[model samples]
Structures are given as structure tokens and as C-alpha cells.
Target: MEPHLVTDERLRRVLDDLIRREPLFHRPEFGTTRADFAAMTASDFWETGASEQRYDRAYVLDALEERHQDPPVEEWETSEFSCRELAADVYLLTYTLVLDGRMSRRATIWQQDPDGWKVVYHQGTVVQGS
Candidate 1:
């Protein structure tokens, strides 16, 4: 069976908000629960300038806690994003995150459940040229 693809204004709005300044992931005090995970699977993440990476529920929570000193929000621009269906209820969204004149390719997989859209996977990779 083919996975169901999703393309809705509401979903885009929500995703845009999450990637904007003061995103939930950067908030140390933000609450993250198991509901955000898919079967407690450890998500993959690659932060800019990081040589190695590990991301899971606890890892993300701890990282947020350690990021208590929030940096001043930089002016950022995001390119048009595209989405594809990965499974019955899972969708993969890919876009470019532009900050400080640098662009990073960002991809996130979200799953819809009774609790709404939950991010099951996310990754950001620095783009070298063009």
C-alpha cells in the first residue's frame, strides 16, 4: 500500500512556527514527552559544527537544559519546503535553514497521532555551496 501524503496549510504553519525564532527545540524549559517519539526510537540529529551526534528524547531534553543561555535570535530565512509520505501516518519534510548567510539542509519526519503531529525524526546538515 502506498503511504498517504499530506499537504495542508495548517501543517505548514505549525512547522514554520517551530523553526522560527525561539523554536521549541531551543527552549530549555520546554517539556518533551514520550509522545513525541515513535516507539521510543532514537532520532538522528546533526547540529552545525558538530563532529559527532546523538539524539533521542533524553539527549534532546538534556541538550536543551544545557542551552539555558539562549543566544540572540539571528535573522533567518527558510526556503520552500517539500514533503513526502514515508508511511501510512509518517511524512518527511525537507527544507533549507538559512541563518547568518549560511544555509543548512533540514529534514524532519512527523507522524500524526491522537496527540497531533509529533516529530519522529529530524536532522540538519550544513550545506557547502549553492
Candidate 2:
């Protein structure tokens, strides 16, 4: 596969890991090493919260962990798992995260290079705050 697609695929897998409630998702420092997301930080709550009235990946994760455990991987929150390429090197990943049965959205931005992909930016929003 093209390096970009492979990078994107690996990045997508990280997203899936989180949505699927992979216990490792708690590590805020993971995912950065992936060939495709070397520039990204494990999802953050502060950054995410700032994007929309105060919500971040960490915040949501904490909230979710506080209430739910091993949420259904298929039904946890992100009802979907896909991204749209906005540019040759830019892509946006959209998905839902459920914490305490409340659903929120997390958006991650990625940039691509000839060697792999990297998460250049990210943000999250508490759409329902369940």
C-alpha cells in the first residue's frame, strides 16, 4: 500500500482502539509513535474542550472511565468509523465517544508525508454530555 494509506490505516486503527474501548486507550502518550501520527498527542481533553465550549479527549475519557467500563466496542459511542480527505496531506476523522452513556464527538486532524502519517491537530466536543 502507499505509505500515506498505510499511515492513515494505522491512525484509523488507533481511533478504533479507543472507540472499541481498548483498555490501552487510557494511555495519553500512546498513538504518537505510529508511523502516521508521530506529531499527534494521545487525545487531549483540554485541547478538545477548547474547540467547543470546553471539551477534550482526556476530559471525555476521564468522564467515561468514571462511569462506564469496557463499553461495547461496537456501540460505545462513535456510531461510525471513517474519515474524509480534505487535501492530499490532510484528513479529518469523525467519531462518537460515549461516557456514562452520554455521547460526544471527537475529531482528529492528520497530515501525511512520503514516509507515513502524523496527527497535526485534534479536537473534541461534548455533543450530549450524557
Candidate 3:
């Protein structure tokens, strides 16, 4: 079976769902490997590597989860999405999350193939003190 030919919009939706609908605390994408299923299966922040070498996903989530703060809404907003760096099967997506009315500094990267798009890497930063 072939994967769906996902557009840049669909790709963003997938990530939005992952962040909005799931237990995930945060997410972001890096400029490293998103092709390895093992890498994707596990979170990146738990591993060890240089700031430029490691692209961890779980680490970002932990950061968010650590934030005991509350927002008016917990849903994420698609501030901007671009595929200018995407190749045929690989692409990068940057998202700004807004939860409970508070804006979250989060970014994510997605990979597409015969299996559609999956969360490869994600990082959430604090854009505001809220």
C-alpha cells in the first residue's frame, strides 16, 4: 500500500493533532535524522548529543509537562508552515502552540513515505513567561 500524498497543510494538521489531542506536552523538529523508525519511536531529549547533533522530541515534551502553568486553552495554533526545505519524502515544519490562550514556543518536523506522516522530532521553547 502507498502512503497518502500529504500536502504541507495536511502535514501541519497531523502535527497539530499530535500536540493538541494527545498526552504530549510539547513537540519540535530538527535538521537531523527523521528516517529512522527507532529514532522516531523514542523521544530525542532523553539521549545524549551536542546541541547541534541531537534532535530530541521527548525532552521538549518534558519541558512542557514540567510547566505546571495553565492557559485559557490547551490547543495549538498553526502560526506558519513552509515546505521550502522539503525534498520528495522529507520536510520540516515549525509550529507555534497556544494552550489555554497562552502562546507556546514549539516547533516540529514530519516525515512522509508509503506510510504517511509521522512525528520525527519536536522541541518546545518558552516564548513567554506565561
Candidate 4:
């Protein structure tokens, strides 16, 4: 396999790690704090949710907090992991999330910082059925 392909597989593993550890970061009862999000995202990050758009890191944190306040949805399957290197140590990871028998397209950009990989942006668009 080519070197970039190898790197992509490795990055895919990182995403897998995130999903497998959702009880830590994405669960409500775990009580993930805003400071934890601050550490996970870039300073200027933004994200699009199922119903709202947050244009900066603070707004993103607010959105996350709001979501965490609600009961968690633990039944979801993620597939189609694709990664593209955007720049040195920056990459885009895209996948499909299926929940409630509905699909959503999701994308997240991760930047490799000195501390670790921080998500700089993310978007999740619901796939409407005909």
C-alpha cells in the first residue's frame, strides 16, 4: 500500500477510537464539561448540527452543551470512513451515520496540534428520504 493510504488507515483508527470511547466524551451521564470540548476543538472551530449551525468555537461549545443536556441516543452505526489530507497534519474525515433507520452524512476536520489531534470543524446533514 502507498504511504498516504497507510496514513489514512491510521487516521481512520483514530476516529474509531473516538467513537468507541463515546461514553467518555459524548455521553450525558459522563458529564463532559465545556473545558473538555475546548480541549477537543480548535480555537476557531465551527460545526453544523442536525438543526443549527454554530460559527465559532464558543458557539460550538454551546451547541454541544445543549445536546449533552438531553438524553443520549446510543443506537447509531457509523460507516464509510474516508480521509483526505487537507494540509500538513490536517485531514478531513467523512462518514455516514445511521440512526433510527435514517442516514446522515458527517464530516469532521482534524488538525494535528502539538498536544494531539483537535477537531477544527464538523458538519452533519440529515439525509432526507423520498
Candidate 5:
């Protein structure tokens, strides 16, 4: 069965807001500092990479800090965004990301706090035969 790509009308605004920040940590306007990254993610944030390896918040933050010092030139595209409310002030967002002609499906769980949206968890799975 084909997956649902269109977000519900009720979630349109939230979807739009989240989409802009997706493929997370890639937008410079959101900030590139370690502290910025820390603020964007929850204290226990973790992610499963496309490689299927699990990484914790501290490791990920350290890696991001290193990458920021000498960022790589990346050309990518994102599409097929969908969002669902998982609970009060929490949402699950899913989308596809294409980088260097390879595609991966990404999901991020976000929580809205007074500070702003903070990612609780994230995962990426490479699209087979892509």
C-alpha cells in the first residue's frame, strides 16, 4: 500500500513549521554551536542513523560540534512530509530526504516547550534499491 504523504488539514501549520527544521541540524539559521544543538534537542535525545547504529545525545552533540568547525558541502532535497500529534504538545514527523542521489526515510519526535520545539528522538532508514 502506498503511504500517506499528505498531512491532515488540522496539522498543516505544525507540519509546515516542522518541515523547515527537518533533516535536522542542517539549517544554519537554527544555529550551529554545540549549545545551540543542545537547546534544540531534549536532554535524552537519541537517534538511529541510516546505518542502523544507535547514537546517544552526548556523542551526537560532540560529532556535530566537530562537523560545525568544518562543515561539508551538502546538496539535498526533502519531500513527503507528514505529521501526527502523538500527545499533548508532542508530534511525530516523517519525511523523505535525498542526498547525493540516495534516499532515506526520516522520522523525528518533537515536543513543544516554552523554549520552542525540541527533538526527542529521530531515526533514518535508507530506502532499499534507491
Candidate 6:
């Protein structure tokens, strides 16, 4: 691990907490309904998809609802998690995700709110030649 990837004890806990939620919106354990998804995200949440297209909260939520209507079976492996605090109660989490042999680098900005963790933003870039 590089020095920059090393997190302090306090951040380590945050890292672990956020890791389980990585590749966010995929974990039914955290949320499955559109309303649940909405609660997990900030009002202005947005994301850059692996397709390099930017989507806003409304579009993303609608898409999520449609997808979960008949969710496809996906098996993904996540690793190389690293986290850094960007500001008070806010953190950036980065990791690699491998699904069906295709790999992508994922990053999610999360904020610790009174309710729970809320996603501020998220993005996924497919790794070339993976």
C-alpha cells in the first residue's frame, strides 16, 4: 500500500463503513426501493457513469427504479479501497470493481449525516484492456 492510501484509525472505520456500500446503489441490503435510494443520496446528487455520461438525481432515481423492477443478477468483486476526508463529515472513497471480468475504477463522495451516510456524488470509469 502506498503512503497516501494509508488511513488513520478514525478514517479506517469510515473507510470500512463506506466500503460495504461501494459501487453504490447496487446493494439491496442498504436500499432497494426508489425512495430508499433517494434517501441515501443528497438532493443535488449526480454521477458520471462508466459510459462517461453525466446524470442528475432525478434521472438516476428513475433509472434505478426501472432497473430494480426486475433486477439482473450481477456478481461483482471490489478491492483496493482507499478513503480520504475531503472536509468535515465528508469523504471520498475509491476502489476497483470487477464484474463479469470487466473492470472499472469507482469513486463515491459520501457525507456523514444525522440520518446516515448520504452520497454526494459518484463516478465510474471503465479500465482499458481489462
Pick the lDDT winner. Answer: 5
Instruction: Write down the worst ten-residue block by lDDT for model 3.
Output: 23-32
Residue pairs that clash (backbone atoms under 3 angstroms), model 6:
none
lDDT of 3: 0.44
Encode model 3's per-residue lDDT on 23-79: one tens digit a residue: 233233421223333344433333222233444555544434344344223455545
TM-score of 4: 0.71
Best by TM-score: 5
Return the TM-score for candidate 1, rounded to 2 decimals.
Answer: 0.59
Report the Cα lDDT for candidate 2: 0.48
**lDDT by residue (tens digit), candidate 5, 1-130:** 9875667799888998999898899999899999999999999999999888999999999999999999999988998889999999899999889987789989999999999999999999999534
In TM-score terms, candidate 2 sits at 0.45
Tell me how far the alpha carbon of residue 73 in candidate 4 is from the true structure, in angstroms, after superposition: 3.6
Give one digit per residue, the lDDT tens place, for model 2 in 4-123. 222356456544544443222333344312321223333331344523555454554455454344434343534555566678656666665675666666666655565444444556
Looking at model 1, the pairs that clash are none
Model 3, residue 99: what's the lDDT?
59
Error of 4 at 40 (Å): 0.2
How high is the CA lDDT of each candidate model? 0.54, 0.48, 0.44, 0.68, 0.92, 0.91
Candidate 4 residues 8-55, lDDT tens each?
555666656445433224544434678777787788888777676557
Candidate 6: regions farther than 4 A off:
1-4
Clashes within 3 Å, all models in order: 0, 10, 17, 0, 0, 0
Off by more than 4 A, model 4: 1-31, 52-54
Cα error, candidate 4, residue 122 (Å): 0.6
